[model samples]
Target chain A: MFGKGRFVGIISSIIAVVVAILVGMVFALISGGNIIDTFKAIYMGSFGTQMGLASTINNAVPLIFTGLAVALPFRAGLFNIGGAGQMYMGAIGAVLIGLYVNLPSVIEIPLAVALGALFGMMWGILPGYLKAKFGVHEVINTIMMNYISIYFVRYLVSNGPLNGVMGTARTVVIHKSAFFPILWNYPIKPVSISIVVAVILCAFYYWLLESTKIGFEIKAVGYNPKAAEYSGISVNKNIITAMALGGIAAGLAGACFTLGEMHFVSNDFPVEMAFTGIAVSLLGRNNPYGVIPAAFLFAALQASNLQLQLFAHVPKDVVNIIQGVVIMFVALDRLITYLLTRRKGGAKGIGNT
Target chain B: MEILNTTLLNQTIVAATPLILASLGGLYSERTGVVNIGLEGMMLAGAFFAVWGDYITGSPWVGVLFAVGIGMGLGLIHAVLTVTFKSDHIISGTAINIFSLGLTGYLLLVLFHTHGSTREPVTQLPYINFTALERIPVVGKFINEVFFNHTPIAYIALGLVILTWFLIYKTPLGLHMRAVGEYPEAADNMGINVNRIKYFGVIMSGALAGMAGAQLSIGVLTQFVQGMSSGRGFIALAAMIFGKWKPFGAMWASLLFGFGTALASNLQGTNVAIPNQFFLMVPFILTMVVLAGIVGKSIPPAADGKPYEKENK
Candidate 1:
């Protein structure tokens, strides 16, 4: 079902890679660092050793879920910027359940996780509903929802019944039963149980997009809602479904942060993961599978940024520069295709913007 | 009662200055079809740059110009991505925001060696004096302090609302801009350069939004701090929607929000004894209430997010 556009897409990808590397070089020079040393530090930071690689992958866990959250909606031609908000809500949900409910390990774990997904689903569904029913833009609503989600968490932890007994804007530590099993006990090895969950999510997402009717309908609606409606597909329903599923993905990301990394709900927990997921999804070309590598690449950059700072005196702001370039590249895909097609003197470009 | 009334009126106008300027900025972009969600980022950058410029130059006027210039530069980046390359507008806008946060934070760390930078005894913009007219009594005190006591830019913001209203409804360029936003292909076929119009709209949006930031740092707060723009840009977006995309109407919408903000802040020391956080939440809660109530009927430009492409079929 994939289009012939993949060929041009791959070629443009190569061009993007070259352009990005060059941009990196230019940035390195501007920052008074040698290009060679920066690349070396980046390598050591991400995958020079087994421990490094694991840390990189560990960081990728949330990115995968968050990326899918965004990419799934894009498939339905919806922009779900509320992933940050949804993800935070999910974290709050899971943390609340994990902290309060005392149940068997298996039961509590799954239940807490489910709460996260449910929270995210609810958050995602609102914007989807607004778009489907009222034609209010999901982009604007989701963005707004993120603020609400963030503040709601603050309010809950600061003054609500859910506030930690210590009077801080954080929840009580989740029960041992609620914790995701850590992969290792080593101090330097930061990898956790969330990686396994993230991988499972990746598989589920692949199946959802490629092997399901809902997924097919989502793509159809995204490509052309009018035609899909004409052809008996309920475009509104599919759009809502896509947004809900996206929310679930984001919710899972939030749960991973709480259950795997923090083990408690704190105000500083999300740490821009929701926003980073948008960048990861965009960089990954909106492919569910592509999110894995894209997330790792970004997470590794984030993970290794401190080391880069130590090695080259190249500040961590350079990572922001790199990410900014990557986003610009991905967003400029249609432009890239146009450039490539023009270079070949073709009668047409690969397709949509 | 008269004294209290005059004081209340003064507070309202003082509170409305930033909102008025920023909302006008929103009007400029959204009316022309490119949703300027990055107005907050642009404003934040402007605030930071204005502080940086003023700190180094010791002239607030130079700082204001510096802010306007920086705002335009940021707008140019948005225009290139959204208008020319046809990137996802929300994503691109979010990137600008993230970038502004990180870039300014990083720059502050590097230059000031601090997270938030405030000048020592920062020089605030000089308030325009109408003291000579104050002898006219209760009405004169109200008029002088409330209306005429603001910085020069506040007056400029009032002018901007009127100017923007005219531009959107009267001028040929404004007509073309609205046409491009409402129906780009139709506008394109009519020989209007949709991309050019979008570029202009975004650039102009940035300039005014930047001025809003300048007002915050130079006029009101007298210093720049990280995340200082806070949610003001989004608040302006809410105002733009509440106003139903008319410039003068947006000014009124902004004033309503500004009134809520002033009320929340003013009640801090009084016996009403509400929590400060509640005060902070007032504008945002009002925004949500406004958006939930009004967004359904507010129609954005027809071709708002759809990046125009030349003939392909």
Candidate 2:
């Protein structure tokens, strides 16, 4: 991975990020913001202070899981846009157990998280199974699954069974035993151990995909399902496993967010993060290790949402605009690469541009 | 106590109008080989711009025109990315969605002082009331209520479905589009300009989807709500699949899903022992079953969603 190719990737990534920032600046200027002050405010909000930095790390924890959810599936050439649905299922499973069960924290927390992963795994298997059996496309199937899971969650929360004491849209707070252990940081919001879990899972993912036989078969199927099948690898099995693993990661994201931060599941579960995970996966090149920094970049940008509103007078939505622009350019990076190589007179890559 | 009534059917037609238009949009693009999941985003942009256009010109028709322009512009971006750059169709569609989501919100804040809902102009599109037919016997009132009382876009949706059917099955241009979607190399060998047809299909899809947005904003609700298209775009795609990608089949499927939506909202608080969300899930669940080939095989065009490139040799 350490070569001229890696250097080129780093350079292009910088270029993409820079262009995205410029686009954001343009939006700020359009919204009647002073350029330098907005830049300073964004800096001050995201990385300038210890408190802000802690908040950024906390924000990144969920993104790390969601990003891995998307990245994990891309390893098997599957597009898992169902992260939002998977996350909701995770939250539901965790909240259901956390709200109903009584146990020691050591037992309850992990149990709830595991249930969340199981729920997400069930959701993931639907699309994977459909795609493998009927040759139906996963993209549309995953999207349908998202709506189904989302509406089911809505039913459970709003007056179906899980409504809180006040009978509002949210559930009652989970038992304290279900809470993730909080890691004390530099004041403000305490960062949860979820970040450690996210990092550990990423490492585990690296080993699972790179050093394991099952991982090799999964990747081989993604590279070419026909070839993998001819070589005695079960393409269908790998596809379903890849999707289920993604579901587990997304479930962890939702469970962690609920247990460590929000403490209850609600309608406003940051569904957009699922789409942002796509951008992260692209930036990370679908590599688990790369997801860490990519998630941080997005989370830090989102951290400046309030500062952008207060100082720049730009709406908080502008950060999403910036991220959207970033994803667009990143998606177009292949075109940029093609142009770069054409300048140096190189051959086209494996896939035609 | 009765759930099935003319009022419900009337509501079904009204709700299905947007789905019909958007699914027809999906039909055109997919028939020409481009999978346009960005219909959701495109519709949102159209909804916002329709309100903005009405605010600017004080005319709902002009608002619709604005929506068409925005939708086509977004469609052009999708075409360039998927067709020329050979980017992943799904990825490019996702980018377009994200881009439109932000752009509409950004512009809404810039144009209107608030977030979420826009300032709706009082003037909306007129409904074509067929009160003259009420002078007839028993069926007259039923016909007027269910068939003729909707805004003009409803009729346009119907007209375009027929038009799309004729164009796709009858016209030479549509033949070229179908060939490009099914076998681009073969089409190219037969001297058809494959990319040109695909661009037209995609742009037309955007135009129709934009009109769908106009229907939502100016016709149905009389204002633009943030993310108002919701998952209708994706639902429209499912409807298209249920209809076997034919314009007429898609139209009927839209009406069925639209009926589901209408029933879901109407029965939200009723003691029917079933949650409204379950009704809402029916269309999606049915599409999944159909895709699984339980009832019938729902096959797409051969080259659908794959980028086409002319030989450089």
Candidate 3:
């Protein structure tokens, strides 16, 4: 679902996505790529076959989780750039249990996931606390936390106490007890029940943000802090809550990647995926409903990396540019609002966050 | 021991040169009320283009010029988005960063026909060595090694610090820039062109940042490396804050962080008990600590990051 919204809002969002894709295509054309072949390759790579569709879902599963992580804070008008660190913490938490704990499948599975979220929540809460208490900006703080967490993980997997075999740069294989149940037994990477988890979380996200009072307070705080304070909302409290909740979502993303897909933790996890969540959130207009399709599109485009390179001779990095373009288009929210609103009250700075 | 300190100090200034340049660039944009987190991206694009330009032209000067132009281009985009489209400053900066990352990586493949890095090293900027002074005793040797022996950009960085201080504090234009940042309405009432000044500040930042990136590729490394800027731009941001947004303050802060980086690099592979990762994290951790400590007490420009919208009567 694209969310129930004003017609202009829906049109603008769609136009943004289209314009971004077209921009990517233009780049491809300029780089001597055959547009017809590139299009065919992209189509066939992500959606052409049963395996392709399954792969898209499998890949989109983690993104859906991370998309929620970014979009939730974005709703509260905070940019949680620390998703990479939060995800790393989550994966580490899940892996530590998956290797060290010996328990029944059901109990250990949920326990690992919960602890993963808890770890991520802790990591996220620190910056949120600092921003709320002090005037400390979260973007730089979160970025610092990401480097620290990434390096911390590097230490754990490479030479620290949690390192598996010598020079392997990975933790030991996670126990079967923590494995996500297979929904489809694909040969390369199985489609897990985590897809179901991802969907349910998206649904829950929609309900939490759209229908709940907590979400109302967060939005109010985001819309105007001083005004929100007058309306009996504690800005500090909402800031912490939003970041903590976003942490939980990002943590789940890591759990899905680790336990459901990789089945073991490694030092070289794709932290760029966390950055992609920003693109996904912006493209989704920071809505849970829109995030599903937005995540699917990004996952599909990413899956085309191989085919595009093989047939069209286009580097898959074009996808990254495409995502960046989407963000650029989305960043024109004020201009779009200005045009749509018939120039009422001109654009304001809104807020720094 | 004196020799060792001299070596460390030399390394510190060399290492800090890029940060010094980038933070000064940030000083300009911020002084005009635009928050530029995209310094990282602008620097990155500059680094890629620097190598590309030199590889094509057989001259590092051309590469430095290309970097300046590209950096300014990106800065222009930032200005357009924040000033013209009235987009949120941070979001636009984030977009610039991502866009620059992909563009650089992609262009690296297309132009260089190489992945990740270039095989051909470009000509490096000449190091200003006082070879004759090396003949003298300790004081001459110290003077030669400590202050004089560096790439030209390092000297330029130092020069710019003094220049920026004079420009920002002494010049009428600098007062106008600060006025625009502090209160656009007042500046506009005084007949200052707020948007034009902001564009100039932001574009100037891009040029300086781009030059900083060139320093990384051509001045320091002599070859372009993927992700070479590697958070230096953000480190510069931290320096800007730590320096209280003053040019001299930021230069000192940059040197402090650069010293930490030099120590980390120097300590690598040593028998020191600390993990290399922890050593690598010192500057970042320090940045966070600095932000947490300084933010409440240290104030930014009142209207910094707020897009100036002309009042419609």
CA-lDDT, candidates in order: 0.78, 0.84, 0.87
Q: Enumerate residue pairs that collide in model 2.
A: none
Better candidate number, 1 or 3, judged by TM-score? 3
lDDT (Cα, tens digit) per residue for candidate 3, span B120-204? 8889988998879988886888888888778899988999999999999999999999999999999999999999999999999
Which CAPRI quality tier does the interface of model 2 achieve? medium
Q: For candidate 3, what is the DockQ-based docking class? A: medium
Off by over 4 Å in 3: A1-5, A345-352, B1-4
Give candidate 2 misplaced runs (Cα > 4 Å): A3-7, A185-188, A343-353, B119-121, B294-296
Better of 2 and 3 by TM-score: 3
Return the clash pairs for model 3, or none: none
Q: What is the RMSD, in Å, between candidate 3 and the native fold over all Cα?
A: 1.9
> Residue A335 of model 3: what lDDT?
69
Backbone clashes in model 1, listed as residue pairs? none
Q: Give per-model TM-scores.
A: 0.91, 0.96, 0.97
